[model samples]
Target chain A: MQEKQKPYAYAKSLELFARAAAVIPEGIYGHQNPAFVLPGACPYFADRAQGGHFWDVDGNQYIDFQCGYGPVVLGHNHPEVEDAVREQMAKGSCFNHPTRLMVDLAERLTSLIPAADWAAFAKNGSDVTTWAIRIAREYTGREKIVMARGAYHGAHAWCTAYPGGVLDDEKKHILSMRWNRLDDLENLADGHKDRIAGIILTPYHHPTYAAQEMPAGGFWEGVRKICDREGIVLIVDDIRACFRLDVRCSPHYFNIDPDILCVAKAMANGHPISAAMGRKNFRESAEAVFFAGTFWSSPAPMAAALKTLSILESTDAIPKMERLGRKLKTGLEELGQKHGFRVTASGPAALPYLTFDDDPDLYHIQAFSRHMISRGIFLHPHHNWFICAAHTDEDIDYTLETADEVFPEVRKEMES
Target chain B: MDEILRASLFLKAVLPLMEDLVDFDTIAASAISDKRLILQFEVKNGPSSHLRIEGGKIRHGIGMHQSPDIRLTFKKPELLNRMFDGEDVRPGLRKGFFHLLFLIREFPKLAERLQYYLEGDGKKAVDEKTKNFQVRIGLHAMLGGMATVASDDASLRSIADETPFGTLLVRILPDGPFGTFTKLSHNGGYIFESTFNQPVRHANAVMEFAGPDAAKKLIDGALNAVTAIGLGQEIKIRGLLPLIDKASIFLYRFGKIMGV
Candidate 1:
């Protein structure tokens, strides 16, 4: 519980940020925006990362739990994944046609994922999700799609996190219903009938800045039933939660089969590769849909993915991460109780979230997160924390002990 | 008749159908009650018309109204016809209905409602079956919610040996309409034994829904449970404090099952 004496120095990072701002739109763009982290505590840039820890630009070191917003499931610079990528890079990255590695990876995916009869590669989660939607539309000859409201599919026009540039016409074909609402989905399907092409959703609702929600009992089963009855394609967007939940497939853990499964993030353990795996029924439409990217057929990420999947299946990586995550969750809950605070921990063990039941504005959470960051632990107040296989028991223990120490400071800040 | 008058007459003809299809009382309870909505329809090279809706009533007239709540200017009669025909209206909007911002903004729901009235009996028949489906599935959700509320009831504890932790009694009060007693028992992860006309005797917990329609909406995913309990004020739960949280989890899970 002893606090670190050194305050985080960000002079070098601030200088780099100013230089990047002159050229880059917001200096550091996307999710890595400095505004997303504590204004002063978190460094603006990461110099390098190894194992379960990362160092910021100013040479400040911390145990990283964000996992690069969900890639890096095994850890930063995993030897096997890196070695595979290195081998592939030696030959080449991309070509006019896909390399043999593409076929190998596709075969591997089909062998593992229950729904995957055919596999198509892409560069990001958005690419695969958008392609899956297109395939659904082509297969069913339907225009409308149903998605859970607030579910982050990707940064596509159909389901963008931001609405600045997206047009109304872009979202016209998409209909939204509350997550885990079986009745609503049924009504929507019944009301729309043959017009609905597909219903896409995450395995669970994990919206930003809120408590993550796990699927309730019979929820996935009911969804499968409705999709089967309605003849609408069921799409599981497991980009963020893949691998972390199950080695075979995330949907397998839920025991519900989807027609199309979209995966990314941890597939190659930080490689820029994504895939849309479809059932046999969707084979024709998947072929017909015009889904192609230049770098999509690159062998490097696919090579990494093959190695990563093989390692994941062979080793105790997922189980160890789950154990570590559970330990962290239990310790946080106990600490919350001791501090006379009601804490809500949700989602799967490997991907968990901690939030104060009573604090909606996240003031205490922000203060506590900042404290954690300052004390060499990288956890986000508004985002679910990730646990990788690289994390050791001592790392988790250090994090918990740090959290216990910071709870009082958080309480005092909230009181003030 | 002029184009405006003709359109007005069409609106009047569909008023009854709208009433039959939409539950105004329920809509009023949730939203859109005692509020005035004016829809101005503009036609190119033709007369314009305005429709006024207030408190579940509809009236239409020729010419435009200033500062209308929603203004829809159709560039072509075919576009409006396609909307009334329940055809996908996006094509029409993209074709030239740029001025019809509200229609474009709302899209299918507004156009689809008009199509529902236009399609007449076929649509009604399908809607009736959908409503029935809603009721059937909704009943399950109601039972589930009630079971959660009464998880720790003495009656539930008595039957816990037989049904385990999941036991429920749904009592539809006669005050609103469609009063009936249903007993739901869970065995081996599946729900079994739904007995009707059975009294609340030997049941773990009891839940009262305002009416069958309310229950249908609640279960149909048309109405949120929390909103039904809070704003709608239609469902009443009587159970143990600790059991309430447990019931909420059950109800939440069941609601997801019913809706998803």
Candidate 2:
């Protein structure tokens, strides 16, 4: 049995957290909240991050698998992307007028993404997703939108996870259907008919804290058929799963084409940029819709995106991430067998979520995550962990070794 | 004049317009046809007068209805007039003259219809351009009112105080129709600065929405701010996660006081 690791010290983090809590509600909000993670295990603040690694304010180094909540696709501070950003920053980061890099990035995306003939840029995933919906509504002259029941397209009123501040009237135009249930989507499209503007979905079902479910066989085809027959726009929100699954697009990886594609998160290797790409049919309507942001045309992020895309296209980043993820998954499974536990890992090899078979309240998974954190590896208990291109074979070997050591501890905690 | 007389006079002046704006089809669709809302008037030194609205019609009488589903009490007729005049009624809420109670879920739609009747183009109160101007002015006032309320309200102050020192810039898009943005800074207290130009420093959070209409919908609670953020509809937010939540809460609180 491996010796029990010392409790991760968080004195500086705790002090910072106290100061943050006094000045900020809940200290850190959204998915980063300490409540979401093992409360006393993870650091509240990060000091710096580089390839496949980040350090906490308390000087604790972690082999990061969370990848800044799915943004750091290549790695933190990727040299190429940073160089591009630096070059653009010297010229000017943003301007009163649009920069040439915006056009370059847009052209690059349209060429790379199969369904994209035209593209529009925005700052976040929500911006592009909402723009897609608005364009769909404008194009179809329809009010109703259909979406997967639990799919989070973005954090707007039409599809927010939380509805505390939303109005019924705002949501009146929106409808929901079960993911991977073609019949449910067909029924809605048939029932709503020409009133339906669009049907938006992720390439796969990856709801939070749950095992991800790929689309049922022929589910995407059926959805495409329904949207085509019903004259409804098909939107793919590939914000989280983009680039990791495939270089072209997640939909392309699954052998399907969406009418509108929303891409962000990993697109620029942690840069703040999202794109709404659409077929030629949506060009007129997309132009008709009023969408503009003060910083949307910024050159630095666009240049970083251009460089990130170039690296992804030229390198074996995606394949490497997937391979490393598989190694981690296979290693954990072997450790689970050795420790008399059933570890289940799901989703794409690149984006994996781990859980114990019988862990309902996620106690075992939490213990496992705490152990991982203590051993200098960072993986989320309730969220899908990302594998970046920067994770090397040595990193994978070390992670597997740590996992092998921690499995017995996890089993002991579970038994206790 | 006595409170009852004042209330009765205002009710008589506004009831016809309110009735015209009712949209019974919407109410019926809302499944609130059976529900009754009591407009209770707590007059100063006078007998209270109440109007019961149910089944898509308004009936005037006191103690005629039992167990009102929603109750809106007005202490002064002037406050009621201010609401009718499309002025910010948040001050009334702060001053304790106006109060509303109902299912929090139902409040948004109710607020929407009430606003349509109150500030909406009722029998051509003003020309199209003037109406547009008034809408813009109203939005500015609401933004300004939020800053005022944030400064005074203890809960809001605590939220501001607790928020990691940062500034939230809310930019209303489409420079022509409603060209303004409000910057909310939380260092120790809160400071709200409204301007058209971009701020010098990168704000902790930036919430962008399409136009005044979208902004109004959000302010009046017809549009869900989080949903807007999610759907990318007319709104977008980018910032520190905690600051985003704090800014959302601050906006929601402001909306609540505005009777949205």
Give each candidate's fraction of reference contacts reproduced. 0.00, 0.00
DockQ of 2: 0.02
Pairs of colliding residues, candidate 1: A181-B259, A181-B260, A182-B258, A182-B259, A182-B260, A183-B258, A183-B259, A183-B260, B148-B247, B156-B204
Off by over 4 Å in 1: A1-6, B1-260
Predicted model with the maximum lDDT = 2
Model 1 TM: 0.62
Candidate 2 lDDT by residue in tens digits, A1-416: 22335457777876776666656655666667665565556777899999999989988888899999898999999988999899989988768998888788888988898999999899999999999999999999999999876577777877775545676677788888878888888788778878999988999988765678888889998999988889999999999999898999799899887999999999889989999999999999999999999999888888888998899989999899889999888888888888888888888899998878875545678788888888788988878999999988888888888888888888887578
lDDT value, residue B95 of candidate 2: 26
lDDT of 2 at B98: 29
How close to the true structure is residue B102 of candidate 1, measured as C-alpha lDDT? 37
